[model samples]
Target: MGFRDIAMFNDSLLAKKAWRLLKNPKSLFNKVFKARFFPNYTIMEAKHTSGGSHTWNSILHGRDVLLRGCWRIGNGKAISIWQHHWLPRKHPPQVLSPMVDSLADAKVAILIEETSRQWNHEMIDGIFTPMEAKLVKAIQLSRYEAEDSLFWPFTNDGIYTSKSGYRFLKAEDQSEVEEEQRANLLRLNKTTISSHQIAATAKERLAEFALTIPRPQYPRVASTPFQTRWLPPSQGLVKINCDDATFKDQKKSGIGVAIRDENGMVLASMAKHLRQLYTALEIEAMAPSTALTFATQVGFHNGILESDSLVLTTALINNSTYLSTDGLLMEDIRFNASYFNQLLYSHVKREGNKVAHKLVRHALCILDFSVWMEDVLPPIRSAVLDDIVGFS
Candidate 1:
C-alpha cells in the first residue's frame, strides 16, 4: 500500500464517498457546504484535522512510525524545503533560524536548477546554514524527471517493511526501559553512578556488597589423570570454538573464533577488537554471531560452534525467549545461523575452550581486526599441539 492508500483507509468507506463527492463539484457535498454540512472536503490529502473516526485516530498515532524511516527522493517540486522530512535525519533540510523569512515558503525546487536537474549551490549556501548547506549538496540529484517519492531509509533495498517499522518503534521504548533498569541498579546503594564511569569508591562498595552474599560450597572432586581435551568435528563438518573478553576500564570487548578440521588441525583463526561499552554478559552473547560471521568468511558451510557461555548457548538453542536487548542479538544470531548448511551450538568448559580464550586476550592488544589461517599464532599453535598429544 502507498501513502494515499493509508490516507484513504484511515476512514476507508467515508473517504471514498467524500472523494466521489469532491470530484463532482456540483454534488450535494459542495452544495451543502454553505450550510456547514461538512467543514472541509480535502480528505485525500495527508493532513491532521480534528474529529476523525477511530481508524483515522489510530493511523494518526502511527504516523511517526512511517515518518521516521522515510526520506523524500526529490524531483525538487512536491516537497517543501523547510517543512518536509526530506533530509537524511528524517527532519527538514534546514534548522530553524531567527530570520526564517528568507527560506520559509521556499519549495525544494527553489534550490534546484530545473533544466540541468542539479542543485544550485550558490542559492543553497546563501539560504541555508553551513550544516544544512552541506546536507543539501550531498544529496545526489536524480536526472530523471520523476516526481518526489517517499523512500524507506532503513533497508538497503529502499522498501518499507512492517518488520523494519516494528523494530524502529520498539527501539525507542526499549532504550528508555534499559536506561531505567540501569538507573535502578545504581540507586541500590543510594549513589548516583554512571555505568560507563563507575568510580573506584563505587567499585569498592560494589565489590564489598558482592562479598557479603553467602557462598554455596560443593564437595571436592577426586583428581583424574585424564583432562577434557578439544575434540574434532565429524568428517564433513568443521568445529569452531568462540570466546569473548571485555576490558571494563578500556571500554572495549574482544571476540575470538578458532575453526578446526575433523583431524583437529587448525583451519583458520579470527580475532576482532570492538570499542563499545557492554556488560560481560552482552559481550559473551555477542560471541556466537561474531563467530558465525567469521565461519562464513572462511567458507565453512557446516560447523559445530562451541562457547563457554551456557546462557548464550541456551538462548541460541531457544530454550527460553528473551525480551531484553540480548533478545534482539539472539534474533540476529538466529538469522545469521540460517546462512549455514548446518550449524549447532554446544556449551564447553573454559578448559576445553582455552585456545579461543587465548585468542580473546590476543585480540585485546591488537589495533585492528585480524584473521590468521595456516600459520596460526605461537600460543594457539602450542595449544593445538597439546590437544593433539592428548596432554593432561
Candidate 2:
C-alpha cells in the first residue's frame, strides 16, 4: 500500500493511548527531573521549570544529560518526547512557550537519528556502509521531490560525503573501468591455464597411450535391456534416416538418427556428440547406438534404428563376426553389434537421410542439451516434406 495507507493504519491516537498506559510518562518524567535536581542541581534541572524551554534543550541538552547518566536509562523518555513534541500531530495540542514552538523542528532531528540507526544496521548487515546507505536513500528520496534540493544542509555539496566519494565516477566513465576489469579477468584465466598446462598435457598423453594398447580377451559387450526391451513396436514398415560426422583432427565424432512411422510421423530422433579417437567406422557404430539409446530413454521401446552405415548395419545382423579390425575399434564394433540386435537396426542411404544430416549439422552448434516434444507435429506441405526427404 501507499504511504498514506500506512500512516492511516498506524493511527497515532491508537499508538498514543497504548504508549500512555504502557510507558507511564508522568512517572518517568518525574524520575528524570528528580535525578537531575537532587544529584547535581544541574542546568537541565533549572531549564525543566520553563515548561519546555527549547525543543533542542529536551532533544539535544536533555538527551545529552540522560545519556551521560547511562545511554539506555532514558531511551523511552527521549523517544516519547521525540514523538510528542517533534512529530506532526493530527490535532496539535495547545503550546505554552517559544521552546514548545520549536517542537516542529525536532521531527527533522529525530528523523535524522532514526535514519542514521537504519543506515548503521544496514552497514552491520553488509549491504552497504552507513555513508553509502545514507547517500543512496537520499538519492532515492530526491526522486520524489519537484526540484533538486539538499536533504541535509551540513555538507558543502548539499549531499552527504564519505569515504566512498573519494573518487568521483560518472556513468560515462564506466566503459573504461569495465574494459580494465575484463582484461584483468582474462589475465587471471590465462595464468590459471599456464599453471595447469603441464599436468593436462601429461594426462592427454597417457589417455592416448591407453587407447593405443589392446585388451586381451576382455570380451566387449553392449549394454543390454536397450536392445531387448527399448524399441517401440512398429506397424507395417517404418522409414529410417541417419547421418554421421567425423572430426579427424580433433579425434571426435557425432551421429544423427531419425525414424518415421509408415504414415511419416516421427517415432524418434536422436543426435550425439561423441568423445573418441575418431574414424569413419567409429562414427558409423556410434550413430546407431546413439539412436537406440535416445529411443529407449524416451520410452520408444520398439522403433527401428536407422543409420547411414551399411557396413555397420550388416555386421550387426551377422553377429558381429565381420568386424573389420582388432583392438579398441573392433571392441567398439562388437559392442555396437550387440546393441543393434536389441533394436530393429536398418541401413539407409545418405540421400534418404537428409533430415538426420540436417539434424547432425544442427547438433554441432549445440552447446548443451535441448529437447522438443510435440502433442502433434506441425503440418508440412509437400514442398517441405520433399526438402527433408531427399531422393537417392
Candidate 3:
C-alpha cells in the first residue's frame, strides 16, 4: 500500500467519537499543554535549605507569576487584574532599589567611581592593585559611621586618619614603600638596557656585507678545451645522473650528482648540502654544479649535468638571470657553474634520474664522507645515467 493508504489504515483503529473530539480547538490546546508544560510544572518544587541559596526569592516568584499569566492567556482567559497592574511594574523597583541603596551605603559606588582614577595613577606609578585604596576608604567611612573597623582588627597599627598624622611618619612604612619603589626601578632599568642591547646587536650583525667579485669571462666556444678535443674511444660517452638528499623532517637538504659513461660505470660522483636553506630550484642548481665541479676537477670537462629540477635546468641552459633572493648561496652556485668550459645541463624526470637519487639517499644514510669509482665507466655518450644501484 502507498504511504497515504497506510496512514488511513492506522487511523481507522481509533474510535469514531474520540477522533471527532480531537478536531476541537480546546481539545488540541489541552493536549498540547498537557504533553508539553504540565509534566514539568507539576513536578517542580520550591524548598529552602541550609546550604548557600540565592538571595533573590522575589525574582523566582516573579518569573512563576509571569508564566501563570501566559498560561491563562493561552487558555483564552484574560490576564488577572493584579498581574496586569502590579506584575509589570512592581518587582523591578523592589529588587533594584534595595541593591542600589546597599551599594551606596557600603560606599562601593564611590569606590567604583574612584577606581578608574586610581587605575590611571597606578599605571604610571607602577602600582596596580586597588586593595590599599579600598582599605583606606573603608577605614575613613567606618570611623564616620562609628562602626566597628573591619581592616583595623587584622592590623596592629590603627588606620591613619590623615597623611600628616604621626602614623604616616613612622619609619617602617616609609622604608617599605622606598624598598618597593627601588625594586621596581631596578627591574625597569634592566628591561630597558636589555631591549637596547638587542637593537644594537641586530644593527651590527644583520647588516649585509656586500663584496665585489670579478665575474669569470667565458672563453669562445671554439677556444674551449672540451670543444677542441673529442672523447677518447676507451672513454665512453658522457651520462649525467642527478638526485636529492634529505635530512630529518626533510628540512636540511643536499643534492647528489654523478657523471658516468656508456658502459653503466661511474666516472665521478659528488654530494654536498647547500650550506644555507634552499628552495627546490636552488637545490637543483647545486646538483649540477656539484657534478660539473667533479668533472672539471677530474679533467673530464665535456660532460652533461643532469638535474631532476626542470626549472633550474631550463634556467641554466638559457643562461637566465639568477635571483639573489635566497642570499649568496644562489650566486655561489652560478659562480661555481661558470668554471665548466663545456657543460650541457639537462632536466630529466625523477624516474630517469634514479641512480643519482639513490646516491643522495645513500649519502644521507651513511652520515660520513663516501667515494665510489669504476675503471670501466658506462658506454653511453651524451646519454643521461638513470640506473639506480643498490648500496653494498
Best by TM-score: 1
- Give me the candidate number with maximum lDDT: 1
lDDT against the true structure, per candidate, is: 0.67, 0.41, 0.41
Residue runs of model 1 more than 4 Å from their true location after superposition: 1-227
**Which of 1 and 2 is the better model by lDDT?**
1
Q: Encode model 1's per-residue lDDT on 279-341: one tens digit a residue.
A: 675677678888888889779979998998887887677755443324445555776788899
Q: What is the lDDT of residue 327 in candidate 3?
A: 18
What is the per-residue lDDT of model 2 for residues 59-113, given as tens digits with 9 covering 90 to 100? 3332222211111111122322223321111112112223334453332223222
TM-score of 3: 0.34
**TM-score, per-candidate, Cα-based:** 0.46, 0.33, 0.34
- The residue pairs in collision within model 1 are none
